[model samples]
Target: MSWTSFYLIVAGLLAFTMLLVCWPWLRRRNSMVQDSLTNVQIVKQRLEELEREASEGVISEHDRRQASDELKLALVDETSLQKEGSRTGVLPLSVGAIAALLVGIIVYFNVNQLDKVARVQHAIDALPRLSEQLAAGKSEQFNTEDVRDLALAIRQRLRGSPEDARGWMFLGRLWMSLGQDVQAIEAIERALAIDPQSTATRISYAQALMVTGEAAKFQRAQEVLQGLLSENPENDNLALMMAVVSAQLGDADTTRQYYEQIKNKLPENNDMLTQLAGRLAELENQIQDVPQGSELDTTATPGFTIEVSIAEELKSKLPEQGFLIVFAQDANSDNRMPAAVVKMPLQNFPVKVTLTTDNAMLPSYSLAQLEQARLVARISTDADVAPSPGDLEGELNAKVVAGQTSSHTIIISKERK
Candidate 1:
């Protein structure tokens, strides 16, 4: 049964116990009232005796009357009966009620503690957020390396043969984080193939397509998403993805409908909600022509570049981005910030860039968590701005730890279009 149901059941039992504890007292009060009426009859008999003596002339009326009044007062001051009956057993009953209440409280606390399911969910929620924190560098305020380590541990659980779809999806996202477009695509496709019914997987796939693939591929991704929506329009995950894609495609009404549903449906504390809201605002601007859309042609981007200058000793076993933006992630966390990004900038590929993870960007002596993070960067670029795009190198992920700079040296020479 649910916690609420258990609580109500306990409350009802305590209320019943309270009634039982008071039952004896209620019975005693009734008995005392009945005994009081009996005393009244005894007093009447004494008054009648005094009247008889006066009628027989055995005593003067005044003297007999005085004796009768004195007897009546004596009865009132100190009842001739050994009865302190009403005071009995009240303390024990009161003590029992307090005991019952204490027991109920103990049960409540213990049962709450025993809810293993709740604890598991709490852990799950925390794991994702911790990963995000590490990526965003929020944990830099504390021991960020620890957060990075934690992310790696969680990711490890998602691995091992007989992969969980959730695990593969997480890894795919992590690949995106490390600026490894090719790996990201592989991981995401693995997840989709594992669970085609999952809208979550499809949306993740679409994000990759939008940034990494060609226009034709972008259209195909949109079609895949549309087919999913046709199966279940109200699917919250699909609705959220469609909202952004629709806005990107310049569909105002449709995007707004999805936005409205998202406001009511998105899980509290989800990062996606904020991203969607910001995008929705931009879509509004696009449709309303509020100051009109910028004439910037991001389509001109050629691609991005990266450089892996790890200490020669630590240079091997490195992952690189080619024709794709690559992302390296903490194997344990869902974080993407601690990752590095590079642009490919050529052959209509994802902004591909490269960087060395373990040697220079990371400190000589790394924090414990970063050691396990499988250290990497993410990559992406604009198509409408080539040549220069190819020359552009991505930022360093050293920002994961506070007080660190994020600048990088030129990784590629600029080539004129």
Candidate 2:
């Protein structure tokens, strides 16, 4: 909700409350005024009657005079009493109204934490701009202070809107961006709890679990990915993540199984298949060692020498503390998980990196498995696990020949949207 709307609602409630508190006093004051008027009218009518009676010889002048004085005294006493009652009633009502207003102000400022609300609202208002700047690779536009303020705002908002799954997810992503994996996991778990049926939220939760790099967390991530894969068997992304999780858990058999499932679906001579085959072989070699003099076969490994550069016009947009990621994946597959990947701090343009079986993201997947692959070079300002908006990226399809290192040039010409 907007701050303006919140403030308006609060003001309206306070006005309604004050009216309720003062209603009885208002009614009583009006009744007293009416009664005073009625008494004056009755006294005037009686005096007129007395004058008529005296003139008609119904009473002597002396008796009439005495009656008139008594009547006037009674009227004076009644008027004075009514005035006293009015003053007495007004004092307490005024005091009560003032006290109630003061208490309301105090409660709004203290109990409700109006100052924190204002800060939260300010952070909320600044969100879009902050996101835009960050996405644009302008890290200098924000700082730790800005992030802290935003985190505090999200926490405060969640207190009042605990059931907002999207809000929780947003907070989780924010924490992830800040490299707070534990907090990110907690937040995404909350989102998943709120929306158990959301595939995206579940995927995010699993990713957070995997980021911790713990064996137990890897098992948990595997479970989550397996569950998702069961529900949507055709989802290559889930299958790929499952393989990675299994590899992380040291489950070589499961990793190879998932690898083969994905590998079989690709076209013949796919680049990822070559990488996967070499990685699978390596996994097997780990279980059974060869003779001391015998060396592991390197002929099955696929290699790529990548030359990465940026477009001339986009050079100025490069981030100061960015990373260059080069990876090879199956050319025709919808899955984006790379069979082999390399990450290095971005320093200069025309940077060269070599990808081999050792660079495989999973132990059972490597460049040796594919005949044709999509070579990608990306400049990630935030070091995100996946490509995101404002990140510069370039890709080209290349053929993979086992035992032969291919050279390719990738020009980072476009920003991811």
Residue lDDT tens for model 2, 1-417: 777888799899988998998898889889988998898899899989989999999998998899989989998998899889889988988898899889878876677867866777788777777768868999676787687666767787799999999878878977877777777888998998899888888898888877754445777898888889889988877877777677555477988978877876777687655655655665677567532454767565778898998999889888889899888887754344577877888887889989887887666456765668999898987544465557899899999887888889999999876
- Residues 1-417 of candidate 1 have per-residue lDDT tens digits of 566987799789878878887877888767767777787787889889889989999889899979998978877754534255445466677787788789978887887656555654454556766767668978555353343344355455664543678767776766555444555667788888889888788877877665542333445566777888788877887777677665444456777888797887767667767766665665465445323258743343221133433233322322343333343344443322223233343332222243333322222112222323333332224322111222232323332332232333322222212
- Full-model lDDT for every candidate: 0.54, 0.79
Residue 249 lDDT (model 2): 53
The global Cα lDDT (0 to 1) of model 1 is: 0.54
All candidates: TM-score: 0.31, 0.48
C-alpha lDDT (0 to 100) for residue 379 of candidate 1: 20
